[model samples]
Target: MQDNSLPVDIDRRPGATILSPRGDVDMSRAPSFRERVREAQAGRPARLVIDMGAVEYMDSSGLATLVEAMRNARTEGVELVLCALNPRVKAIFEIARLHQFFRIVPTVADAVEA
Candidate 1:
């Protein structure tokens, strides 16, 4: 198994690709997170969903990484969605006003459908 600092599971479906990241996403792990995202985007899926249910903490670096990913997704014409954000991660988004720009869903099913 690959030793990922931030464990991420990529599920590539027909149209939407889901990236599930577990554990805290801080400075030490943002790079790994970003790499995983890049790997997911490399497939050129129609939509990208970030399932944040298992992430309990995320620092600014993590948020910045996500912002960068969002920009990349926009440029690539890939729909970026965030699903199942735990309360802490959701608060971070709200604090950064990122929630206003991101498509956040209550569940993975909703993200895939969206």
Candidate 2:
């Protein structure tokens, strides 16, 4: 099996914050991911973008974190968008039928605009 454990990177843009997460998001790492996202949401931007293009694996815990992040953003009246999802992560979203819960885009620029 491929080693999927890696750290996720979070960055900022003008109108939105970008989280370029890498590696596997599983039970062991989900809390860290949640903390990172929470930190970003705390900034209270009008929109937040999580770039999943580099993510190689995403399990249920990862999905749950994303869902919670979205909820947090919503409560804060900020738009939470997902962008650049790799095939693996996209598949997980499909499996969970949560592909519609987020505003997904093909690139960071697109997500930032939306």
Candidate 3:
């Protein structure tokens, strides 16, 4: 794992590709995050998981980026999953009712299995 200030770290597994982003994901970092998501999608993996364990904060732009990524993944027939969301971040998704749209799991292992 890297300790850089930047958002994403791409990790490839046997059947899934994980995008782990650290720190707050706001407007300033959402574009970069989106680009990374696109790159992961380009790989055409059977599954794509956004490991949000390191994310302490997220804004509407970040949520928008995720929504866009989900759309792209669906269009390409990729299964997009999210795991390890912090409490605040999880609450945001719940409040937005995005949990209905996303397959959110509590851990990376759960995401991989799902």
Candidate 4:
């Protein structure tokens, strides 16, 4: 667990860093999420996996934050993967045509392997 204030749990795997956030990802929480992601990327893991299984909802701000993370990951040469997205959150990315850019998978295990 990185921070108690943020609903994030960070786990370090063999070659990946997994961040699991537990709540809605709206504007109110997007900043914290961004900070958490940034911190995870700071470690320079071969892969960064965001487990969205607990996230039920996400707004544009949340999506924007993810986009920023994606850009940063590219610059850092870290593979970014998002997994366990609920239908609602997954639909948001699909509707925005972001699914084409993001490596989204159905489970954390899949993301870890990806």
Candidate whose lDDT is highest: 4
Better of 1 and 4 by lDDT: 4
The 0-to-1 C-alpha lDDT of every candidate, in the order given, reads 0.90, 0.85, 0.90, 0.91
Give the clash total for candidate 3.
0
- As a TM-score, model 2 comes out at 0.90
TM-scores, all models, native as reference: 0.94, 0.90, 0.92, 0.93
Which 10 consecutive positions of candidate 1 have the poorest summed lDDT?
Answer: 1-10
Tens digit of lDDT per residue, candidate 2, span 1-114? 644344667677677888887777888778888888888899998888998887788899999999999889889998999988888889999999999888899998898877
Give the TM-score (vs. native) of candidate 1.
Answer: 0.94
Model 1 gets an lDDT of 0.90
**Distance from true location, Cα of 21 in model 2, Å:** 1.3
Clashing pairs in 3: none
- Lowest-sum lDDT 10-residue window in model 2: 1-10
Clashing pairs in 2: none
lDDT digits (tens) for residues 1-89 of candidate 4: 44324599999998999999998888778889999999999999999999999998998988998999999999999999999999999
Candidate No. with top TM-score: 1
